[model samples]
Target: MSGGYDLNLFASPPDCNFLCSVCHGVLKRPVRLPCSHIFCKKCILRWLARQKTCPCCRKEVKRKKMVHVNKLRRTIGRLEVKCKNAEAGCSVTCPLAHRRGHQDSCPFELMACPHEGCTARVLRGALAEHRQHCPHGAQERCPLGCGATLGPVERARHNCYRELREAWSWRQERSRTLVLGLLRRMREVHRTANLVRRQLAQLGGFLEEEDAMLVGAPQGEAEATPEGSMGAEM
Candidate 1:
């Protein structure tokens, strides 16, 4: 009778699963129900909210059966340490359960634009758009004394000064060529005047020579003819 009707025969200990089905982390704040199944309180609560089932055996457990155990809370409390982002200069230390909340407001979590010359710093969510139109990003400047800042859209305008400078230099060169041509023409005129003066002097010399020759011949012929005629007439 003692072996067949023992009152303690129907009692069995609850099964404690050491692993969380979702995160695979150690079960802290273990929760248990009348079905003799155990799980972490936080993990089971989240799982129950999605579907009321035993995380270990997948047994249909009611959401009301989920209970928070103080022992597991104490265990998780001790595991809380400095945030993982502490290496990135975050000085806050919080529980793993609250780490996500702490990271949202973490000052050291700021991200700077990766684009060149962009000094803008923003949250992780806004980094994409900030990089798109980064005002301080890579830009060019006018090299031909335009003295203005330029972006990709202004590159053509920025180089306009080069063409303008070239045009001005061409005009200056044309003016210089014109002045040189006029000077060359004046030199030619001066040379022509000098040649004409020399020719005029030569012509005057020839004329004087002809006049003397004519006068001398006329005088000699007159003298010779007069003597002959006088003899013939007598």
Candidate 2:
């Protein structure tokens, strides 16, 4: 290969297969501990910070005697020029010494919460903690009546108030409509009574005029009229 070591250097070596268990990254600056297990110095340091054990055999390696093996560092240095996240958009090639920093801020790194209405970003190391708290992030409203924004903890309270307000508003509107309908019906009844009174007044005026005409008529002629005959019979 164009790089220093054969691309297949660690390809199932017959006697000893060498690979960094943590990243599977080519091990550079290799260090062999008293336990006869080897790991890249940087990888071992990070691994030991999290856990104190050999990556390959799970043997306990003390923090003190991790000797520097110079040959492994040179091999890893040459292999570092390949993209760590080739599937992502990272085209930069550098030594393995810089791979950790590059991967830390890789743009293609998967980070955000997958939950709806949550916008929290999670790093690979902190995904578990992020998922636990992300559900409590701000949630969107239902948008039908009173639009209220609330966090997960307060959603129940917001929904309760919203429904109550809608119910109260509906009752108030119905009451107003009922009152107005009753007033309209009452006005119609009053109008009909006024019309009946006017008609009765007209009928009374006609009766008085007839009485006056009967009194003015000749006495014998008035006595022979049907109304005067009826009055005499009564």
Candidate 3:
């Protein structure tokens, strides 16, 4: 980046009419005095505030009538300018009017250090170096959903928190497995209870039928026994 920062050499020199006589820079907000000599709007205004005379011709004027030169304003706006951070790895060039907007988007521009309590604004290309020494730069979040966060050099502190999280996770998984096993046993018990109730109902129906057959038999046949037959034979 340091090798390619000469933007002025690439751009054509601005015309004399497009330059500000006071600042010697390209015309910015040009204002045409009644004398027909043009100067930057800000330059002429600042000069008139002190004394009512044109900077170029020293012409005295009472009204100090100023008109905006739209044609020249547009011409200056089209002039090209290189990024101010061209030495910081930026190679972008845009119109002069867009310089401010382009500079904001340039990758080489400075950004505030991300570390807590640090307020250093380093260029993007140099941010790595700044972060290397920043206290909070290497911090990482706990992957096990713990609220704790720790940095690389602070590994000893993180180990205590990591072991607790792992232990809690294992206990939760074991409890879940136990609950599933209990549910399966409960389902088997419910099925066995249903089978027992059905078998009891069938046995009760068979017992009732045998009891009815004995009650409906004649009294003589029920009273006859094998003992009467054995005594008659003797």
Candidate 4:
């Protein structure tokens, strides 16, 4: 039981001298067994089912011989007690008899979301339907680049810094690849320019050597022509 209600805690002692032997709490719906030992209505019924003897003195008891202790019930009803969820932060101190009822609806109770990663604390009644549309518990992937794909409930555990680091890593990798490609192209262009310069130098040297050989051949042709004309005239 939630909503600031801790049903496990023993009920406070009532004003009447009567207390249920089984639960040790103030009598609720007190009933008198045939042995004359008074017990809570639920306690006696449960005991009678297992054994037809009163728990107080082991005397024989019958299912039909039980009687209601109306006076004790009224007295217990007036007893005041702390709220069931007092340890859980509920500060209401109400009648002991009304404790169960009051705690079921107490507003100060701390109720957690059943969603896996969500730590949201809400009122008791709001828990059941709160997960139906809880954004954190929705099924989705982390867009922040952590590569986390999970349900909304588990998504609460995602780390923001890790996601940011992953984004930076991707950007760096892409930039590095682009830079390497540009450097490779530049190297290839430099190599091509060097090859072109070397070819131009080799071509210019070959043309200069051909011009020297042609100029020497033209002088030899001029001397041979003069000798042939002088011999014909003789």
**Every model's TM-score:** 0.31, 0.28, 0.51, 0.42
Number of backbone collisions per candidate:
1, 1, 0, 4
Candidate 3: deviation at residue 22, Å? 2.1
**Could you say which candidate leads in TM-score?**
3
Candidate order by decreasing TM-score: 3, 4, 1, 2
Off by over 4 Å in 3: 1-10, 62-64, 125-133, 138-234
Q: What would the per-residue lDDT of candidate 4 be over residues 132-230, giving only the tens digit for each residue? A: 777666765565666667775566677767768898999999999999999999999999999999999999999999999998997899989988999
Better of 3 and 4 by TM-score: 3
lDDT of 3 by residue, 1-234 (tens): 121113262256766667677766666677788888877777777778898887888888444488889898887778777778867767887887788898776768999987767789988777878878776667756545565676766644567656887999999999999999999999999999999999999999999999988877766565775677878999
Candidate 2 lDDT over residue span 92-129, tens digit each: 66665576676777655568775566777755556756
Runs in model 4 lying further than 4 Å from the true structure:
1-16, 112-119, 123-234
Candidates ranked by lDDT, best first?
3, 4, 2, 1
Which scores greater on TM-score, model 1 or model 3?
3
lDDT of 4 at 142: 69
lDDT of 2: 0.66
RMSD (Cα, Å) for all candidates, in order, is: 21.0, 18.0, 10.9, 15.3
lDDT of 4 at 22: 81
Cα distance off (Å), candidate 3, residue 97:
1.7
